[model samples]
Target chain A: MTIPVIAQLDELRSTVAAWRADGQRIALVPTMGALHQGHLDLVRRAGELAERVVVSVFVNPTQFAPTEDFGRYPRDLERDYAALSGTAVSALYAPTAQDMYGPNFSTKISLEGPALGLESITRPHFFAGVALVVTKLFNRCAPDVALFGEKDYQQLKVISRMTKDLDLPVEIIGVPTTREADGLALSSRNVYLSEEERAVAPRLHMALQDLAQVVSRGDPIAAAVAQAREALAAAGFDVDYVEVRDAETLEAVEAHDRPLRVLAAAKLGTTRLIDNIAVPRA
Target chain B: MTIPVIAQLDELRSTVAAWRADGQRIALVPTMGALHQGHLDLVRRAGELAERVVVSVFVNPTQFAPTEDFGRYPRDLERDYAALSGTAVSALYAPTAQDMYGPNFSTKISLEGPALGLESITRPHFFAGVALVVTKLFNRCAPDVALFGEKDYQQLKVISRMTKDLDLPVEIIGVPTTREADGLALSSRNVYLSEEERAVAPRLHMALQDLAQVVSRGDPIAAAVAQAREALAAAGFDVDYVEVRDAETLEAVEAHDRPLRVLAAAKLGTTRLIDNIAVPRA
Candidate 1:
């Protein structure tokens, strides 16, 4: 049964808390509500893991840069509802921007990291906004386990770091990145790509796949990364960053840490997509 | 028999949780472990509120500024144990800095307010540190209610703000500032003062009390604040700031909107002290 979307804070708590007391274990999938395969994957996983799944579909305005695609970002509820019609998602908390951000809502948690190097440089305050809003969502939803897609690899890593470091009693589970048969990483931003740019976007995945193959073959660190950089350039993609870091810590590989992730972000036309794969253990 | 000083996290949890489960309501009073009468008042208040009380004696290095007296701060376990010996306190946790701050400690929460504006001018990262460490303590202690002293009025307000904003499941009870008979606010820092400085230390309280009196007489806010500043100067105390702010919001008030707090901070030689009063509702 689709519980109606709750917009107000007080109503949301009372409504959810009532459900909680009735022995329903909640699973929350926090998203910005441009529902795609990536979002559905999260919803389906939450459905699998919990008795009642709640998907908070509010597009947090603070997470967007003034110059980023906050206002212009595509949003359609009827279409999204159509997508998750038969899924385990019990309700959608599609609150307005005003309801989520109160007049006195100013304080935010900020995280600095080795994973946040170049990605942070381009989108300063991006992770801070992401961390804070996710934190608020955790407080509101009170889920036992949260499901996230590794497509936004750093974000999943950041959530894990924040959860453990703060001693918040929630388990973070990362599902593999969903991708098109042709290999473009599944993203809500893919809507912005034109036909030609969309055609070339799969080069991102191919480059990352090549890097994973090299690292698996026990190639020297610098050489494997360089080969992937060359492939991205040859594929006509505007590369944002590519780093091979320890999967758990997100710390840059100093002397060949096992279970590394070869991560990449590249722009095709107006859209940016990221992809990552684990470097197999020796 | 006195409760043992628990250093292990797991040991402390079972000891406290068992007491709580037996229908003994629990209260926590967190301290930095020098254990003065001010801290004892908080423990005493906790005892009054609940059947079981836990006193956490962690100096909280995260709350201390890097250049501040984190290393030099007083710590006396033998004396602290002797002090809490005869109290109704059920448990004492004295986790080390390394235990609290493990291998990749990163997440920090910031509390918002003009309450933050109090000491933020001199110590920029102070409230962020305070908010982060207190949140950590709450997670570990998991008390039904926590006791704090309003002597560090801004710190108490910030902790309460974070608790409410985050929907943390703990009641915050602010006890009135405990002071010496001579009116000097009791603090571990009082040990740093020479006898001459200690003699004038009570002037900080006198100045705040004078402002409280002026506001009571219906004087203009600016005039009452100015008179308090003059009082501090006449007592040879180096005045840091004197102002009126909303009792709840901590926002500046030129005119009374709600009950206001007349607050002052000053230095007598090397000792810095702060005091505040809830101005009678106008």
Candidate 2:
């Protein structure tokens, strides 16, 4: 578990190529350097999938809005390096802000799918930033596969599409959400919630669960969405959106042919949390 | 002098890797099919620069507009192979349209450059197509350096900017133009010209030469552009554009701080011709 820290771009390329030459399969775990348990699970899965795992800790500024928490975002690399010391990661590509973005940088990619709608509502240009940085990391790491957690369900779908669309020579292996003993999904933003805010956060999960049950009972797409909206309102959520859309197209479900997501975002006090549950059928 | 023809993308990757394993530096000469003397010059130069040269011939469709001749594009593999029979090109990657654009492929790149204005005037979506296909070829080949010709001046500049901006892991090398006996720039589209059209085509080059002579006298930028336009009109050309602008920024020049281009496009009857010359600062 000797995780080498790489800063320079060319040096990272040669090091990864050396790993490939040794016949060791490589996996990438991309992160924003706020190594909560949710992100740690992805690194663990990367270890399980390949002989060598690379944990990329880049807090991509392009992915955050000007009004967003890009400046105040937490970064404690020494603590993160220690948490992964006993795990499967072989390197930590902890590049600085300048290392990733220089003066000549100007390419901006427009991302599609769930991220577009979600980010558009709260943080404009958020998905473009995510798309640009993720593509950058993909080019940099050249990983055999990349591990992404389902906690960021929309993000996983968007990244999977980006990798496939661009013919990036890496597979995106999605890991399931890591959660507390309570039903709340584990996330770095969870730290910002107050005691009362934290207790009621599970209501998001409960609302999703209620919608999933209604969907299984053969309610139409509109009904399932309606039920979920009511549940969130009853729980005192400042509801952002509750959408029922085709899992594949990320568009409104015209006819219920495939998987659907009952997705929601809400603000409890000052913390904003998002979650989703796949409706197996509707 | 065995010019290896690699069909699959993976085979090209592995073969390049094997050559690198044996300590051979590789240079890539990427081209759209219909190889003329200009493309051959690129291949020859690649052979000179590195121990191994990989020439890729794919008529990338993404860069072609709906009205352009994509399906009807000429491909003379037998002729091309014969032309390079004695050259030291270690391999030739001539993939089918199927291999390059997979069945479900649907990603397109938009290159935001100063030449984007020309795209709207000439062949909207042309630069986007150029950027996407060229970037794809760069990723697939992963060469020590890639070669482009100065004939397509805007394209060379765009790709150079793209490589720098993206931090792509390859060096870009530019080769001077290879001209026909009549001093006409050799292009695949030259075949489309009628005998009379072909006779008048060299006048496009003549007009640029006259403009360069005027610019050499340190005439004001607008005055030199006006002179180029008059020369094109005198040569019986229906001019599309004739302007002098800074090379890198593509902005209209006030003074010569850098290289400037006297660029022109015209239609001699049904056949369109374009040419440019670098203005020598007096």
Off by over 4 Å in 1: A8-25, B11-25, B47-52, B85-88, B218-223
lDDT of 2 by residue, A53-153 (tens): 88999888888877777877778899888888887788889888887887645455665455557546787777667767777888888889999887777
Clashing pairs in 1: none
DockQ of 1: 0.54
Give the candidate number with the greatest lDDT: 1
lDDT of 1 by residue, A92-191 (tens): 8777766556666646787755436746767887788888778778766777788889988888888888877766656798988888999877888888
TM-score of chain B of each: 0.95, 0.93
- How accurate locally, in lDDT, is each candidate? 0.80, 0.78
Against the true structure, candidate 2 reaches a TM-score of 0.91
